[model samples]
Target: MTETALLPGPAVVASPGDFPDWSQAASHAATRVPDAAVTATWRALNYLCAAQLYLNDNVLPARPLRVADVKEVPSGHWGVCPPVNFMLAHLGPLTAGRPPGSEVLVVHGAGHAGPSALAHAYLTKTLTLTGNGPGWSAADMRALAAGFPHTRAYGGEITPLIPGVRYTGGQLGPALAVAQGMVLDAPHRLVVALLGDGELETGAAAAAWTGQRALLGSGLHGAVLPVVLANGLRMGGPSILSGLDEDELRAYFTGLGYEPFLHDGSDVAGFRTVLAEVFARLRPLGVARPQPVLVLTMPKGATGPEQVAGRRIAGTPAVHKTPLKDPARNREEFAALAAWLASYEPAELFTDRGQPSDLVRQALPDPAPRPRPAPPVEPLTVRGEQAWPLVSAVIRERAAAGSFRLFSPDEAASNRLRLAVSGDGMPEWASEILNEEICHAWLQGYTETGRDALLATYEAFAAVNTSLLVQHLKHRSTRTVTGAGGLPNINYLITSLGWRNTYSHQNPGLVSAMLETENPTVHVFTPADTTRAAAILTVMLTGRDRANFLIADKHHTFTFPPDTIREELTNGAAIWPHLSNPGPGAPDLVLASAGDVAARELSAAADQIAAARPDTRIQYVHINDLTVLGQPDTWPAALPDDTFARLFPAGVPVLLATVTQAPAARALLAARGETARVRVVGYRDPGRPLPAADLLELCGMSATALTAQALSMVKEPR
Candidate 1:
C-alpha cells in the first residue's frame, strides 16, 4: 500500500479547487486535498439535507435536489455542522494507519450535527461499511442524505443502532464523561470526543470537568482527547464558552488539571499539525498517568453559506440552524442553495454509484469493527448477617479481575464498605468523590466502557444524576430493542434510609419517577434484609443489559438463611408462613410490605392485628421487587391473578407498608387494577430527626398505623 500524502497541492486558477478555505483565503493552503473544496462538498451535503428534509436512497440522480422535495418539518441543525466537518477532516489521518482491532472511537457530543457526521461517514465510505441493507454506492449516499431525520432511516441524533457510533447526542453533557469511560482499561483504543460549546455550559459537563480528577488517578489504560467546538453560537444564542478568550479558556482547563491545546479550526493545516503532535506525544505507551488533552477550536458554521439575505450567517447565532431553507415561499434562498451545492462539484467527489471516489476513499480509514465485551463472571454469594460483607466480597473479586469500579459521594466507609479500601486507606476499586454529579459521571463512564460498576450514594442525593440516568437508560434500552447488542449492567445501590436522616436527605422520589418512565429494562429492588439484599445484588452483578436499582439500608440488619433468600429471588416476594397468624380458611386481611424497615414494621403490625382481633386472621407477605405489584402487562415480575388471589384474596383488605412515598405503591396497585382494596403507608417526610418508630408513625408507616388502617378497611364494607 502506498503512503497517502498528508496535504494536497495548491489550487490553480479557474479550477473548482480555487474555492477559499475556512479562513476565506487562498494563500493559507495545504498540499493534499484543498480545504475549501472539501469543506464546500461538506457544506453541500449539509445544505442538501436541510433543503430536501426527506429524501431516500431511491431518489433519482444525485444533482442538487429541489425545494419541492422538502419535508413538512426540516429537522437537524446547520450551525454545528461546519465544526463537525472540520473535526472529521482532521480526524481522518489519525485512523488511516491504525493497526487492526485498534480504533479511534469518535463520541459526537453535538448530536444534532448528524448531517455533517453522516457526510463524513459517507465520504470516507464508513457509512457504506457500517450501513444496513445498503451497498457503498452513489445511490445509497443520496438515499442516506434523503432519508435522514426520518425515523425509518437514520434520524437527527446518533443512536446505538448506527454502526461505529457508541455515543448518542441531543442530551448535552454526558458525552465527555462517556468518552472517558469508553476508553477505560482498553489500552488499544482512543476516544476523540467532539463537544459543542453549548453543551459545555451544562451541569453534566461541569461534573465531567471535576470528574477528570478521578479519571486521572484511575490508572486507566486508555486516553480521551476532548475537542471543544468553540463556535460562537449554540442553538439560538451565543454560548457561554464563546465569550471566553483563548487565555481564559486555557486557564480554566489548566485549573481543571488538563493540558489545553489551542487550534484555529479554520486553519486546516495548522490543526492537522497540532493534532499529529498531540497524538504522537499522548498516544504512545508508558506515559505514567494518562493526562487528558482539551483542544479549543473555533469553527462556527465553517461550511454553511457566509451570507444569506444580505445578513451574515457564519460566525453568528443565525447559523445555528438551516440558513437557506424555505421550500414554501422563499425562492431567493432556494436559488442561493442551488448555487452553493453546485460549488461542491459533487460529481467529482462521488462515483455514479453514489460511492466516494477512489481519491477520497484513499484519504479515509476503514471503519473498524465494533469491540465485543467479555462475558460476565460468576456472582459472589454470601449467606451472612451483614450486607456489606457480601458487597465487599464481590468488589474485591471484580477488582482483582480488573473490571469493577465503584463511585460514591464520600460515604463508602460510613456505609460499612471499609474493607474495600486500599492499603493506603484509599478506596481500591472505589473512589470517594464528594460531588454526587461527579460520582454519577464516573459511574456512567465506567459502565458505558463495558465494565460492571456500581454507583452507591444516599437515596436522596441520587437525584443529582436523575436526568443522566434517564438518558443512559434510553441509550441502553434502545440498543436492546434494536438487536444491536446487550449493554453491560448499570447498577445503582441507593442506601442510607430517609428514616435515618432529616427531611433534607429523604428523597426516594427517583424510584417513582423511574417506574413512571415505563422503561422495560428497569428493575427496582427493595431488599428486606441483608440476605435478600445479597441475593438481589448478586443477580444484578451477573445480569446483562439491565438497569438495576438496589435500595437497602446500610446499617446492620436481620437476615434470613440462604434457602429462604433463593426462594425470595425466584418468587419476587416471600411469605413467612411461621410469622403468619391467619384464621382457619382464607385470611380476613392480608398485610403485605416492601423495603427493610417498612417490612419489619409490618411484621410487628401483623402480631398486633392478630392480638387485637384474633378472628381477623392475617397473611403476611414481603415483597422485594416492587414491580411485582404492577399489572402483568406492565411488569413481567407481577404475580398471576390466581397467585395474587391466594396472596391477598378477592376482597380481603390489604395494607402495604413501603419505603417510598405512598403514591408509588398506589401507582403499582392501580396498574394491577387493585386500587380499590389496597391502602399504602409509606414515607411522608416527617421534617425533623426522630426515633425510627416515631418517624414511621409520622409518615403513616408504623405497625400501629398499618394495623389501624387495615382494621378500618376490613370493617368498612362487604
Candidate 2:
C-alpha cells in the first residue's frame, strides 16, 4: 500500500443540541455542498470539476476528487456526485419543489477526502456538510456553517473530498459529529452521508450514539445520510469474518430510533425508493421521534479478504459486482481515471475561468490563521523505557501462539492506540476508540450494516461458539432445568460471551468479561442460561409443527383472502421444509397457517371433515412453529399413524404450510394396519397421537412405544 498519514486537525459529530445553531451555516452548506454535485455520465460534468480534485484510492475511480486512487464508487458515493447514472435516473428537468439540487452530503475518509471537494463545488446550493477528512478533521458543519460564506474554511491544496475552505488534510471522524449536529440543529434540511464500509464502524458509532441520544431526548428533525460502501472484513472473531445481516442491521438502527432498509448499493431504483422512504419518515417525526437512519450500500468484498488492523477480525462481503465496479479491473481503471483528470485544461473545466477552476476552491469563508497542534505527550521519566516495546513483543508472541491474530504489530505503541486532539493539539478527545462498548457495537453494527451471509461469520464466532459450549453441557448435564422467565441460562451464556440476547438492546461487549468458557458451578436455577437456550431455540425452531396447525381446507385454502398474519405462518414454514409436505396417498389435513383465522377455520375444517368422513378421526393441534419442530429432517418422520401402525401408533391427519403451494395439495401418506383393525389409513397427523392410556392398550407389550422413541429426541436426553 502507498504510505500515507492524515494531516492532523480538528473534530466534529452529529446528534441534537451538540453544537450552537444558526441560519447562515445552513445556507452556506446548502450552496457549497451542492456545487460539487455530479452532473454527467463519466460523472455529471458540473460536479466533475470538484470530483476530479478528490483524493481517490487506486481502487476508486468512480469518484473524481479523492486524492488516493481506488477503483471503486460505492452507493454512498452518490452523496458526492449522486452517481451520474443515479442522478440521470432521478434528475429529470429539476421540477418545481426540487430543492435547488440533490440534497445530499457525500461522506468520505481522509484518504478519499478529495471527492467532497467536488461535492462542495456543485452541491453547495442543494446539499450541506459539517466538514471533511479522517480522524481529527471531523468538523461541526452546523457550527462552521453558522458563519455563512464568511464562515472560516480549511486551508491548503484542495483534497479530493475536502473543501478548499476546511481542508484538514486528513481528519474526518469529528466531521460525523458535525453532520449529525446539522441534522439535530437544522432538522428541516436532509442529512446525507457518503461512506465506504471501512468507515462505517469507526465513524458511525459516536455519531450513532449521538443520533440515538438526540432522538430519545428531543427527537431529531433531519435524515442521516450513511452511504456505506461495505468493503472490508470485521475486526475480530472465530477466524474473524462477518459480512452483515438484516436482523442485526435493523435492530441497531431501531435502537437509534430509526428503521433501516437495505438495497443493492448500485441499484438506482432500489436506492431511490429507500431514500424516498427515509425522507418521508424523517420529515414527519422531525424532532418528535428523531430517528437518524443509516443507508448502507456495501460494495461487498470477496468470500475471504485479508483483515485490516482495528477492523473486525472477520472478513467483509464481496462488493466486486456492486453494479458500479469491477474489482478485477478497478486498480488500473481508477488510477488512469485520476491521471486523465490531472491532465484536464482550465478552459474545459469552467465556462468563465482562465486558470483551471479545477484546483481545490474554497466556497466557504476563510479561517483566522490558526496555531499548530501541541507536541505529542511523551511518557514521564518516572517509568523505565516506557515498556511499550515489551508489551508489543508479548502481544505478538501470544498472537503467534494461537491465541489471536494481531495486525499492524509493527505500529509503534504511540500510533497503535487512538488519541484525541484539539484544534491546537490540546488533547481534545484523543483516546483509543476500542473499549468494551465499542467492540460490542462493532459486532452488532457489522450485522446491521452489511449482508446476511457475512453476519453468519460473526454469529458463529461470537454466539455459536458459546452455543457449542452449551451443547457441550447438554451432553453432560442432568434434569431439564426450565428457566421460567427473565434471563435464561442459555441467554446468559450468549450475553456473557458477547452474543446479543435480543438483536437490539445495549452493546453486549460491555458484558464480555462475563463470558465463561466453562459452565458456572452454581446450579441456582440458571435463568440466564435457560433464556439464552430459548432465544437460540427461537431461531432454530421456526417451523416445527406447521402441518399440525396449518392444514389446507380440503377444497379451499381459506374463507378470507390471505393477509399479513397468514403470510407469517407461511414464511415460518420456509424454515422447516420437511414439515411442508405430506405422504403419497392422503390428500392433506387442514390449511391453517393463518393465525386466528387459520386456527378457527382449521377447527371448523376438522368438524367438516368429521361430518364428511364419520369413520375417520380428525383432531389438529395449532402448535407454534417454534414449539413443534426441532429438526426439519426428522419432523415428517413423527406423524402418528396406526391403521398403518408403522408410521405411528395413532391414527390422525395433518395439514402443512408451504408458501409456494399451501392448501393446494397436502402431503399424502399410507401406512401399516393397526393389529386389531387391520385397516390402513392413507394420512397421519402427530397432533392426534394416542394419549398415554391408549398407548398401553394398543402397544400391548410391543417391542417399543413410538411416542416414547420420538419424545426421547425432543425431551432432555439422559
Candidate 3:
C-alpha cells in the first residue's frame, strides 16, 4: 500500500471559530490543510468499514490467519463505500467548527452503503453500543463488528437510528428534494446530500433538478450542497449518466440553474483542495440563493480489492457486493481479503485497545446533538362555510408563526387555494412547482426536519407521488420503532375529486395506495364540508409521527355546526342527527359518507329516503376520518367493536358513499366483518368530460343511485 506522510499542525476541534475562510485560504494553498488529519481519518474509517463487512470475530485481528475470524455470511455493498467515506471524512473538517444552530447536516442518498456510515458513527463516538465505556473499549468494538448487517438498533440501511440521518434513501430520487426541504427557511444551516449516479435516472430525481428554481427567489433559505458521486456503474451495469462527457454533464447541470464543479477522485489530494475551494466560495453566499453542484467521478470500489482470480473487481460491477463471496472457504480469495484489509493498516489507525488513535481522533468532529424545532402551538380554529377561506386562515396562522410552509404542484390557484399564491407569484413560505413528486418530497423533508408543512394538489395527480408517500410512511414507522424524537405530520390537501375532473384527470389511486400500506401512522381523513375540513387540517398540522391526508373539495361549500367539529374528529365518524329521522331503536337502514362530494350526494339521498318513507326508521353517519372503518388492531384510530356496533348496528344495513374506490372502502369494512351488510357507492374511474352530476351518475355515486341502493337494502330481510 502506498503511504502519505502526515503533516504536523494544531489539533482540529469543534468550535465556531475553527472553520477556515476559504477566500483567504485559497491564496495560501500550502497553509490550507495545516495537517493531513482528514486523510488519516479517512484511512481509519476505511479499515472499520471493512471490519464491519468481513469480520465477525477477532475484529482488531490481534492474531490473524484463521477462518473463524471471517464472517460465516459476509455481506454489504462495497462499490459505494469509498466515495461515501471520502465525503464523510472531508465533511467532518468542513462542519466541525460550526456552532449549534449553524451545524451542517448530511443525507445519504446511497442507502446501501450503510457500513460506511456505521463506521463513521462509531469512530466519532456517536453510535450507541451495548456498553457505554466511552464507545472505545475492546468490548464495544467487538459488539459493533458482531452486529454487522443485523444490528438491532439499525439495519443495513440509512435510517433515523443513525444520528443526523434525516432522509432515508431506501428508494432513490427523493434525496435532493428532501435536502432542499431541510434547508428551507434555515438560513444558517447547510445540508450536504450525497447523491448517487444511478439515482439520477428516476423521475423524482429528474424533477428535483428543477426544484431549485422554486427556492431561487424565495427569500433567505439555507443552501444544499448536492455532491453527485458519479462512479460510472449502477448495480446491473453502466449508468446512463456515464455516457455523458464532462462538457455535456456541465451543460446539463448549467441548464438546471446550478454552477457545476467537476472533480477527479483519482487524485485525492487534488480533490480535497478543490472541495475546500468550493466550500470557501459557498461560505460568503450564506442565506443567498445560489445553487452549486459538485460532481465527483471515481472508481466503483476505489480502495478495495482490485482483482482476484484474474477477474477485475474494483471498477467493475463485480464489486457491488462481497467481491470475494466465500473468502473463508477459498484460499486464494481469503489471501486477497487479508491483503485488502491490511492495505488500510489498522494498526496505524486504531490503538491496541481497539479505539481510534489520537491521529484519527483529532481529525473527527465532536458529536453535536441533533437540533429540535420548537414545540407546536395549539391548532388554529377557523369557522366558515367556504373551504378556501377557512383552510387559508389556518395556513396563514401557521406561516405567521414562522415554522410552517405550503408546497403545491402549480395547481394551488386552480384548486381555489389562492392563499398559497401571492400577487408577486410564489411566496417564500409557499412554493408551487409543476411536479407532484417534488412537492411531496419537499413537504416530507420540511416536516421530518422539525417543522410543519402541507402539499396541496389535485386528487388525481396526487397518485404521482404514491411511491414517495409509501417510502415516507415506512420511514416514519421505522423512526417510531427506534424511539427517535417526534416529527410533525406530513399533511396533504387532496382536492379536485374525479367527480369534477375529466377522464384523464380521474383517479383516486393515491388514497387506495396509502390504505394498502396498513401502516398505523397512515391516516386518511375525508372531512364532509369546509368547517369539518378546517378542523381536521388543524389537528393534523399540530400532530406528530403521522402521514395525514385531508380530502375535501374547494369548488363546493357547506356549513356544519362548529361545536360538533371536535366530536366528529375525535370519533372519526359520527351520526348527523339533523339529517336522520327521529328514532331510538335500531334503524331499518344507515346512510354513511366519507367524502365531501359523497357527503353531499348522501345528504340528498337521505332527504329522498326521509320524504318517501317517513314511517321507516333511518340514521345518517358522517365519516370525518376514514381509517375508523378499519379494525382497531390495524389502525389506532379505528373504532373498537363496541363503538362500531353502536354507530353501525349489527342488524341494520348500511349504504356508504365514498370518494375512494368502492373496493378500498369494502376492504376496510371487511376488517370489521361488516362487508356483507354494507353496500358501497364510490368512484369506479368511469369518468368523462361531463358535468359533475353526469360524472357521478355514470359512476353510480349520484344521489338517485344512493337513494335506490338504500331503499333496496332496507327491503332485504336481515
Candidate 4:
C-alpha cells in the first residue's frame, strides 16, 4: 500500500506500474523492442513522414538546411510531433467518422505537426494526404496530403474556430490558470487539455493543485481528466515517468496531485478508448470537478525504454534521404524535397494551388522591409504582460487591489527603497513581500519613470527597506521620541512580505512585531542590501539615496584610487577557528558593513554581537537584501524543453542575469576578513536581539519567579 493511496499532501514518490519501481519497467522495456528491423523501419517511417510534411509546409527543406537556417523558423528546430503524436493517435482516425456539424479541434501551441496537419486537412473537408503511391516508401506523407480533400477555413486565416470545437493555444507553466478562466468564460464547451512531458513538473503544476481545490470547493469530486503525454524522450533532460522511481511517481500523482489517467502514446487507439470511457464516467457527476486525466505515450513504437525502437542508437543528425539528396547533406533541401515528393507525382502543388492552400505563396500582405525600430508601449510601462483596455473586472481587481497596496513615496530619495525584501518564505511575511513586489511592479509598470514617476517612485522605495532600519534606529536612538506622534515623511510601516508559493508558513510572529512597533517607522528587514540602505536614508531624509551600496567588479576594484572611501575601525569581535566568528574570550559585538567589512555574514555572527551588547539590544542588519543587483544562477533557457514542441505559441528565452538568489553574503563577509567579526546590536525595533525578559514578553510570555523557573529564564529584561 503506497502512502499516496492512503494520505493527502505532497507525495514525493509513487509506483510506475502495477509493480513498485522502475527496475521492473526497465526490464519490461528490454523485452518490448523485440527486433532491430522493426525499430529501424519505424524510426525511418516516422522521420520520413515528418520531414516531408515539414518541407511541404516550407520548413526544413529536407536536403541541406543550414543549422542557422533550421534555427531561423520560429519553433522549427524543436522537432514537431512530440505533442502531436498523442493528439493524432486519438484524433487522426476520427477524421473519417464525424457526422455533419460534429466539429473537431486540433488544439496545441507552436511546432506540433500531427494536430496542425490533421486539423488543417479536415476543416477543408479534403483528403489532404493518403499513405499510398506507386513508389511509396510507406513513410511518404506529402504524397498522402497531395491526395487530400481539404478546404480553406474562412478568410484563409484558419480561424473563426470550429463553431463547436475550438483549438486554443496556451503557454507553459500555467495551464490550469487558463483552464480556470476558460471554464468560467465558456461553460458550454468540452475542454480537452493537451500538455507535453515536463509540464507537470513546472510551476504550472500549482495550477493543477488549485484546480483540485476548486473541484473540492465546488463539491464536485472524482472528476477524471485525460492528460495525454507525448511520452517522447525528455528533451534536454532525462526521461520522466518511463524511468522515475515508483514511490516517487506514486507520491507525486496519487498524493501530491489529482489522479489522472495515464496511457502509452503508441497505444493511441487505446488512449482514445480510455479517454472516451473516462469522459463518459465524469459527465453526469460533474458539479465541476477539475481533476484532470493524464495520458502518457511513447510516440510510434513506444520510443521509451519500455518500448523497443528507441535504443541507444548512435546520435546522428537525420537529413531527409531521397534519390535527390546525397548522403553528404551538401545539396540543397529543395532538390531533395522535389525528388522526395516527386515520387508522389506532385504536379498541381507547384501551380501554387490557384485555389486555397496552406502555403499562400509569396503573396504576403506586406512584402516591404520592416519599419526601423519598433515603437514602444506608451506612457507608463506595464509589466506582467501587454496592456488591454481597463474594462475587465479582473483587470480592475488587479489594478485597484494589488496583492498589497504600497505607500508610494512623495520625495525622490525615499521612493527607491523597498519596505519589504520578499520572496518565498513564511506565509504572513511572504504575502507582505509578494504583495509589495506586485504593487510596486504595478506602480512602476515595466519602465522606469522620472524622479517622481510611478515605477520610479515605488522602485525608489523598494530599492532599500527604510521602514525597518528607521524603526531599528528609532528603537536604538538615544532620544525615545524621535518621531513621537507619527512623523510627516513616514507612512504606515510594512508588516509582511508575502510569498507566491513553495515556502508559505503560518507565523503569528511577524504580525505581532507590527503590533509592537512604537512608532510609524517600524519594519522587519529581509536582509536585502540595496533596499536596506535606501530605506534608512529615505525615512530619515525624506528622499532616496541612489548609491547606497557600491558595486565594484573585481577589476574595477583596482580602478578606484584605493581611497574612494576611508575606513576606520574602532572596536569589534574576532574569529575562533574552532567555534565561530566569536570564540574563547572574544568580544561579542562588532560594527562592520559592506566591502571588506563584516556585513554579509549569517545570523550567527549577528546573534553573538547582540549577546555582547547588553545596555542596548542589537541587530546584524543585512543591508544588501535591498540590492537587487548581482547574479548567481544561470537560466535553464527561458523556455523549457517541452515548451518548444508547440505549434502556435513559441518558446521564449529565460534571459541570463534575470532572477536573483539569496547571497552567501554573511559567509562572503566572513571569508573576506582575516578574522570573522561578530555583529554588535544596540536598542532597535522588534527585530533586534532582545533581553530574555523582553523576548519572553514579546512572544507573549509571563514574568515572575515561578513562570521564569518554568521557562528557565528568570532575569531582568536585557
TM-scores for all candidates? 0.89, 0.29, 0.93, 0.33
Q: Against the unseen true structure, what C-alpha lDDT does each candidate score?
A: 0.66, 0.28, 0.76, 0.27
lDDT of 1 at 560: 46
The alpha-carbon lDDT assigned to residue 108 of candidate 4 equals 37
Better of 1 and 2 by TM-score: 1
Candidate 4 whole-model C-alpha lDDT, 0 to 1:
0.27
Off by over 4 Å in 1: 1-73, 99-101, 121-132, 283-296, 383-387, 421-424, 560-563, 687-692
Can you write out model 1's per-residue Cα lDDT over 1-718, one digit (the tens) per residue?
A: 0001122121111232121111111122234445554454444445444433444332333555666555545556777666666666555545655433344667777767666656655554455433465366655665676666647545566665554454555467777777666555555556677788777888777777666665444553555677787876777778788788888988888887666788876566666656655665453212334444656566676655777678776677766666655633576666665565556565666667766655555445444443445667677655443555776665555666657777788887767665444453654456766777667666666666567788888989887777777877777765665565565688888888787776688889888888887777777898778767766877887677777888888874666444456656887787777567776887777888788888778877778877888777778788888888888887777888887787778877788888888898799789878888788888887666777768878888777887788788768774
- Candidates arranged by TM-score, highest first: 3, 1, 4, 2
| Regions of candidate 3 where Cα sits further than 4 Å from its true position | 1-35, 99-101, 132-134, 283-290, 370-373, 383-387, 420-424, 560-563, 582-584, 687-691
Candidate 4 Cα misplacement greater than 4 A, ranges: 1-85, 92-171, 214-226, 230-232, 245-251, 283-292, 300-718
- Model 3 earns a TM-score of 0.93
Top candidate, metric TM-score: 3
- For residue 136, what is the lDDT in candidate 3? 77
Residue range with the least summed lDDT across 10 consecutive positions in model 4? 1-10
Please tell me which model should have the higher TM-score, number 1 or number 3. Answer: 3
| TM-score of candidate 1 against the unseen true structure | 0.89
Q: lDDT by residue for model 4 over 537-624, one digit each (tens)?
A: 2322222211121221111111111121111110011112222233233222222223211132222334433354333222121222
Tens-place lDDT digits, model 2, residues 1-718: 0000111112112333232222233333334434332122123232342223222221112234343332233222222223322322222211112232112232333333223343333322212233342211112222222222221232212232122222122332333433443333233334344443434455433454443332333332344444443333322211111244667766765665666666544544355456455544544223445454644543232111223223331232221212223322455434443443444332333333211133222322222122233222121111121222222232223223221211111122222221112122212111113222222222211111110100011211233223322322331121123211111122111111101112232122211212121123111001111211222222221211011111111112222222222322332321112122233543233222322223333344444444544443222333233221212223332223321222222322334221111111122221122132111111111233454334222422111232232223223321
